[model samples]
Target: MSAGRAGAQIKSFEAWDYVVFAALFVISSGIGVFFAIKERKKVTSREFLVGGKQMNGGPVALSLTASFMSAVTVLGTPAEIYRFGAPFLLFFIPYTFVIIFTSELFLPVFYRSGITSTYEYLQLRFNKVVRFAATIIYIVQTILYTGVVIYAPALALNQVTGFDLWGSVFATGIVCTFYCTLGGLKAVVWTDAFQMVIMMIGFLTVLIQGTARAGGLRNALDQAKNGSRLEIFDFDVDPLRRHTFWTIAVGGTFTWLGIYGVNQSTIQRCISCKTEKHAKIALYLNLVGLWLILACAVFSGLIMYSYFKNCDPWTAGIISAPDQLMPYFVMEIFASMPGLPGLFVACAFSGTLSTVAASINALATVAFEDFVKSFFPNLSDRWSTWISKGLCVLFGILCTSMAVAASFMGSVVQASLSIHGMCGGPVLGLFTLGIVFPFVNWKGALGGLVTGITLSFWVTIGGFVFPAQAAKTHPLVLSTEQCVQLNMTETAPTTAPSVIVNRPALAETWYSLSYLYYSAVGCLGCLLAGLLISFITGPQKGKDVQPQLIRPVGNLFCFWSKKYKRLCWCGVQHDSETILDNLETDTAWKQGTGLDGLKDGQDHLPGYNPDEKSYTNLASEKVTHF
Candidate 1:
């Protein structure tokens, strides 16, 4: 190791490092060229946006896993575990339910719709205004998320490899944008399949190697247990308890709904499958991959804690931020190993690239389908594809530009969840209301969305702008007084920690709400507001709303029917003949209330041309599995 600028210990790169990096960029770009040329004759917007709706289980599932496990999960998860302990891993408890709920409840609806964008379902169920609101929310949230994902890995790479932060950001952004813009969904999915393998290899390599360096798995576990880092369950009833069983298992399920249930990045992959059965299979497979990746990330944190149990890096001033810990640990464990450091860098970049590609592609699809295509219904397929690709370039540039701002934020994982909870919660609520409450009119949904988003922003942004005094938790303790290797030859100057002052009581209470509760609050607020407004203005008839837009609970229990009576008693009954209404809704399902039938009452919906070419032709042509 040699001292770099500011006397920081920097790991130098070799010829093999450049070779490894070049291979990643080349393979990814090569896949783009392959797809572009292969699908030249039939390059329609339908094909570019959804992979011709003929995707298989393995590749699409792997792509979903890659997109779900972004650089935020890869980089931020280990840091979270290291700081907070094993309780952070409790998110896995809710994930199982999420897989089932999304596959059974959400996936079938989108698959049956045969629409290009997920927001199309909104237009079909309610009105164009609701759809536009959801679209704008998703576009903004995904763009901001792409920037944060790109920044996390780039910042870590800069610390370990002495690479420029902006240079690394641009490198990953431009490579992913180029491939995603040119190759469309085919290129994005295939490259994601490749990158996910690299990501798995990278994490496994670090876990196995770092475990050995820390004297094996048993010793690592013992060290973590002794340090109070292995405690998994916190049964506290306190809402402020960050990782309690109630918060992690219950509240977390609400948070994940916004990601898997309604987010375009995830739904687009599910809809790409040829049949609903294949889509379900993909969801189950994605769950298994998610579990394995999360386990690996958590174990890596334990290994890190064990290795530095007696030599705290932060206390020694070796790493400036908590997020930099894993990268520095990698350099220490694999400094002499020729290709391992390069592999680690490649792994982080892989995760970043997969997420960026998904954002760019999803944003492009939504922009063209939700905005542009509405204005020009008869726009040729060639021009539709062109507009989609052009939007990809535009969003890709915007994503990179926004990523620079993340350097000023704290805790990448928390920052991402804040954005998701604040923005995504309202969108999920809108979808949920339409699906579960058949009587919720467009006016009701729109009112709920606006109010829910308003509350979320007021609390979240207020906390950021006027933060209260820090709330403390008991982190696992460590000692570094005996550590000799981390000691620098020259002494470094230190600054005193800052003091915090309290704010008004209302602001304090607002800031005291856990980030875990943000989504739940937003979601419940929307549902309540929507229902109230629907009752006040006038609820839609059960016959008016499509059955496909309704969830299984609403379908099976017949909440709108007088026969059920129990569940429907929460509010005044809108329909007197419950049994007949339920029968009619079920009949509507049997008769096929397809996308065209969904827009029965609202005929003036902009940009919705039912006469456009159906995806059945493209699906027939590309129906082969790998």
Candidate 2:
């Protein structure tokens, strides 16, 4: 039933194609085995999680880029351009600002904290309850996300190979989990680095061949322009307009913020570097890699639009889903090219594997550091490493099962955004509240978290229950004039359906908001609710709040600050008071005086204690957050 449109001349992969696809699995698993053997003796939980904080910046950077751009991006982007327009490609506009903002402001806080799990910062900044809430939210979000990642490639492979959907799911899921469990973070990062290369090669091959087959890049662009698929920017201010300038450029920034600014998978890479400076350099390098990868995807979209401008598979009903178009196009064009289709399939799964490996590894880290370590304070390093590996296997199976559930969704791309907004937005809001304003106590943060999460679900789920018809839009011009002649035939274009479907007034308005704004709405909701509740319930005194929780700069409204000097024209003076206070605390932690019951009397934890043989020396010259 999951097969492509019935009897639509589906192309099958040849023997060479299977060889290419099998190589990807072999290479990925081989790398995992290589690291597992090399680090067998030293593969402690710390090593499994952060690569012993000794990873080179280049691979880490490449890993971050690969993780961020998953299979959904590679396939969904072209489908988006081909079906809708180029406006969705504008999501990358916020990359530079995000890199600068995260490197200068967010990275310092996390890197300075020396925490393996991002949720650990929640405990450090707030309390155990808040930390647990964040950990649960993160786990749920990642589980859902991993399922989508798994399903994307499986879905694509099914279209190309006629492979069973569950078989593809199990194959990809089991293979990724094996490597992640065996090799840990180093395997994930190095494999990511290798996969990034394969990904680019795959896309470049498609771009060159597809564009040339479409009569060159210039001709493709002209055809796309003629068909109205080249509109890059929509200046509409309407929130319901899916891909407006404000939606993608402004609202989309928060989406990236949730991933790049605070997500565990990304930050784990940042912290795996030798120093905080190396982390920042890796982040900057990731910015370049991110843009390059997105550019290839976007350009491939234009080429797809041109190649399909005539044939129009969706119009001909050759493919039931827009998501299937990418694979179907690959088969239509590259079936005769022997292994090229398999390479493209490998490229898709490379993105998926890297992302899932990073998530599973991070999920294991959080499980051990935040969940298991708290309950069992005296867990030995050997046992802790095994437990983390077990969790990786457990979560991988759970995610693979969830992929079976995700098959019902309309579009993987949209499902992903909804999940991200529902969870990621509120989490980002909690971190933002903690970092920007030191007065928010655990009560306020918890209250805001609950409120934001509830509202996000109410809107997201409500839209699902009471669907509204999407706004009407003109379909692109099409002709079978240049379509590749095969068993297919030209068909008359169908008439447009009515756009306005009658629905309850509340449901109509609620469903009108674009998915891009989901993160922004959740973030703003948390900030406002947090501040309001803080004021009502009596916020913590400014002096009582730890200075480490507050960002070190941008107190422009505080003219009477005692610790910092306020400069004119939106500038901020550097403050060393927080660093000094933290150093004093660090000294206490080192001396075993206890961190005021930090980690529930686990202050002398394996990774934190300066006296521990395994703890790496992370001390460096302090720099201002400005």
Name the candidate that leads on TM-score: 1
Which lDDT tens digits does candidate 1 get at residues 387-488? 877898999999998889777667788778878888888888888888778789999999999988988777777766665444524456666655555344
Q: How much lDDT does each candidate structure score? A: 0.75, 0.74
On residues 1-626, what C-alpha lDDT tens digit does candidate 2 reach at each position? Answer: 01122235778799999999889868966877898788888845557677877788899998888887778877777787777777777766878778887888788777766577778778867888999998999999899888988998998988889998789999888977876767778888898888888889988999888887788888988887888888877798877766778888877887778768889988888887876778888999989888888888888878887777656776556666777878887876785799999999999987788788778877887887788988998988778767987998999998888888777655777778777887888888999878777768788999999888887777777666665445623234655454334453353445698697557777657765777678888888888999889889987665554444457455555557644443221122123222223232343243211112122222333223333322322221122110
Model 2 CA RMSD to the hidden true structure, in angstroms = 6.5
Query: Roughly what TM-score does model 2 have, to 2 decimal places?
Result: 0.86
* TM-score of each prediction: 0.87, 0.86
Question: After superposing candidate 2, which stretches have Cα over 4 Å from the reference?
Answer: 1-8, 381-383, 472-502, 555-574, 577-626
Q: Give model 1's TM-score versus the native structure.
A: 0.87
